[model samples]
Target: MASEELEYAGFWIRVWASVIDTLLLGIVVYPLLTAIYGDAYWEGANFVHGPLDFLISWVLPAVAVVAFWMARQATPGKMAIAARIVDANTGNNPSTGQLLIRYLGYFVSCIPLGLGIFWVAFDSRKQGWHDKMAGTVVVRKKSGTTRPVEFNA
Candidate 1:
């Protein structure tokens, strides 16, 4: 039998990818905050403080939105794992609006106890709820090319 054109990422792979992405984003964001605020920034607060605190509170989410929305993929983790986000039907990269919708849908997916993520385990197409809502799919990229799967159905 022919192999499936698209396969869902296994749970462990997805988990690892999340971890890697979080660490990478933190590596970039934290140092930038530190440099902008300096040692005196966190002088008295129990948590983050001063310009650094504001930056962390506000800028981080905005940056995350812009990065994913503009790129149609997460910054590092998905890229490292050869995974990318695209439109489910056309298998094309998402538009900026689609990316924003997808990112926002992540919040909904996280609600009701993250059942959306678990949908991959049972979905025939292995799509999460967020993927469905946003009309997006995550697929593995070929090593030397950008082509994604093409389905006749």
Candidate 2:
């Protein structure tokens, strides 16, 4: 059991985490993309411009996110807010397979007018569809304390 009190991170905090992550990623990725493909990259008709775009626009973020999850159990944004991802049932770190599924599940959560993501607001466990799909949850110690979340409790 967790030695201290924990809270399910609510919608607003998660949104802020996502915002921070997106902005940070954009800061790094957009310039590189423009440098590699030129400003026309934005107005290009193709979803991806070329090989460099595929590597930059697609592969880089995937690798970075999974790497972060493996190393920290959270992205920089989640880390900023002292949140972590864990197995929904175990309250322990999720396996690599689960983390990958969780990443892919973001597409599913965002597909249906983002109803899946918004589901977090109503779910008793405070899970988005991605979380439910991957059997994972985002959790944190409430306030400034370090009461790590323990799911088995």
Candidate 3:
């Protein structure tokens, strides 16, 4: 967070990170849902098949993601990509409130055909709508070799 050669993570890398997270979540959630609802679970027209479905499919992922953000500054996927979220102005870890806002902002970003998420490709700071809403940014150091993303004390 000094004058070092830092770079905002690009769009494609972020997209890949999200894909990884979604796949991981599916790996766990899908099994639980299938076990509870049986094979016919996939045939439902309901957005949420039942209370357990809502708990497993919706609440679980949300809690997991928020917990990861709180504990690690980045989710597993972002950590895999060597990127972390920080306060846009201070380059420090964002507050819990900011993290929550960022999580909720995902819906807004996706609502308009994902134009807000796509905004990262054009934004000078490579911020998606969620980052903008929460005053955060995703960044990585210009490392010559692969390294884990970590905060400097």
Candidate 4:
């Protein structure tokens, strides 16, 4: 399909979706972390305080987010805003490998003062580095429409 025919999610919508996802994650993560580490949880930068911390902070979130992407095409926050993640070249669900790469690509996107994320604001397709790495795009239902529009490479 022509690019103009698709309604790609822009930076602001993506930002809002991220905010929502972060807040929701906090709702669950904060209490659990606090319960495990007490007041010292926020006081340190240590990544692995214990097995529980490792499980809660690292493993759980990675599994949960990837699972959501694989099963639902979008996270809860993205879904709330009617956005879906798709393979940019095919406008279909991404493969498991692609999704995993996308998740890891987030680290790359964030490492350089978020330049990769900011690229979305300038790119015509609004793809961040992670999106580019995974060959994915975020799209939303077009105005007054029930389905998201398709796009191509």
Number of the predicted model whose lDDT against the real structure is largest: 2
Ranking by lDDT: 2, 3, 4, 1
- The candidate scoring highest on TM-score is 2
Please write out the lDDT profile of model 4 over residues 6-57, one tens digit for every residue.
Answer: 5788888889989998898889889998998998988998877899988988
Per residue, candidate 3 scores C-alpha lDDT tens digits across 56-126 of 98889889988898888889999899888888877788999999999999999999999999999998778
Clashes of each: 0, 0, 0, 0
Q: CA lDDT of each candidate?
A: 0.67, 0.86, 0.86, 0.85
Cα lDDT of model 1 by residue, 1-153, tens digit:
111444445445566778887787778776777688776654656565656666775678667745864665655677667667767776666778777777777778889899988886676655778778888777763333333355433
- Models 1 onward score TM values of 0.69, 0.91, 0.90, 0.88
Model 2: colliding residue pairs = none
Rank ordering of all candidates by TM-score, starting from the highest? 2, 3, 4, 1
Candidate 2 Cα outliers beyond 4 Å, as residue runs: 1-4, 144-153
Runs of candidate 3 exceeding 4 Å displacement: 1-3, 143-153
As for lDDT, the candidate ahead, 1 or 3, is: 3
Q: What is the RMSD, in Å, between candidate 2 and the native fold over all Cα?
A: 2.8
lDDT of 1 at 73: 65
Clashing pairs in 3: none
Query: Alpha carbon lDDT of residue 7, candidate 1?
Result: 46
The candidate with the higher TM-score, 2 or 4, is 2
Q: Which pairs clash in model 4? A: none
lDDT tens per residue, model 2, 1-153: 372567788787899999999999999899999998888888889987889889988899999999999999999999999888889887888999999999999999999999999998887767999899899989887764333445654
